[model samples]
Target: MSRWIVVLAALLTFSSAGAQTLKVRHDHDPWGKCVGELSFSENGIVFSSEKEEHNWSWGWTDIQTVDRRSESEFSILSYADQKFLLGRDRPFDFTVLEGRGMDDTILGLIQSHLPRPVVDRLPEEVERVDYEVNVKHLHTFGGCEGVLRFGPDVVVYDTSHAKDARTWRMGSAIVGVWSVGKFDLELEVYEREGGDLLRTRRFRFQLKEPLDPDFYYHLRRKLVPVR
Candidate 1:
């Protein structure tokens, strides 16, 4: 039976080397987030949610690039193409995946399917952060209160008793921030027009209550990787 045992061991090793299933958290907006199992095979990756009816799989060749959204989350696939070199025919359709305990393992497994250059470009970890800052209305004698909500793709300035808030798209805006008087912050926005400097807007914010000490620090870090 020793020969039979050796054959069995070889078969088990081959099977393990060919496929693996890992626990992960899958996220795709509108469809929402769910805990699932991600199976890695020689051909492609298969994802199955806890719900019996939900299952999807895609091949490595179908992926363009993967974006890391957080330490445990990755935008694994996106589909888009240009037409006639004019502009993109359509926007990207993203496939996002999130894993907690198995993040590194899952990421490593995915990297193995990619080329060395692509694997080197992947981030070790990522974090998504956004917040609202309290700004003071300096134009008027009796200053009004305002809040600036900073997000990944947009920045919004809302004034108290205002009909509508002013919004700015982050893509075409260059913003410079600095610490001002005790617990106050200053923001200067240089709006761009077709790669040229357009106009500038300025605002000041005060931090009355102590929030995260690293709020400003983290904001700068987030902006660096925007491009």
Candidate 2:
């Protein structure tokens, strides 16, 4: 029948839209954790957990914000209040256990679907770059050496320090990027401070090589939204 055909088409659409599912683990407080499946689709995000109480199915409208800093880890900020935390927003943290850990592709998909901006830390995977400079990312006490790369849509710091190497997708991750001189560059971005609050995180880089002004202008231009 014609009605049956329409119904089948709708079903297929729903299924295909949610095809990118990942094996994930949900971590609870001090020492507790659970295995589950986390999926991001056109409809929303779904968590099929072994325990029923831990299960979640949130539409985009239900989310407060989302943070994806590491390739393997991400957090979903929800409006659900935590009584123990004085009615604060509850957060769901997930870690990719299988398949490609929330790479640039997945991050892009999420960014497109979400109505609001997500704190995206996963940098764009670029093969060719416009410029690269040897620099030291400064910390309170010390710093680490890395190659700061400027690509078409992303800026990345490739360092030897584990968990220190970061990629920032231009326009989204970066609040502002400016140069103090040929030997110094500063980048401003949003980072999760405590629970789900996005606070400003500034990365100061001391460049060993001179940064080209022309390259900086070209790269900074991309931050301006196109009409």
Write one digit per residue (lDDT tens) for candidate 1, span 1-227.
Answer: 69999999999988767766656766544456666776766677677778666576668766543433334444444233445435432222223343343345655566566431121112221133277666665543545576666777556666653422344445434366666544676666653212122246565566554435576676656554546
Best by TM-score: 2
Highest lDDT among the candidates is held by which one?
Answer: 2
TM-score of each: 0.37, 0.80
| lDDT of predicted model 1 | 0.52
Query: For candidate 2, lDDT tens digit of each residue in 1-227?
Result: 69999999999987666647889999885468899988788878889999899888998888866877688898888878888889878888888887878776666777777765576554445688888889999988899898888887778888877445777767676888788798999998765557745467788999998889898787667765446
Candidate 2 is scored at a TM of 0.80
Compared with the true structure, the alpha-carbon lDDT of candidate 2 equals 0.79
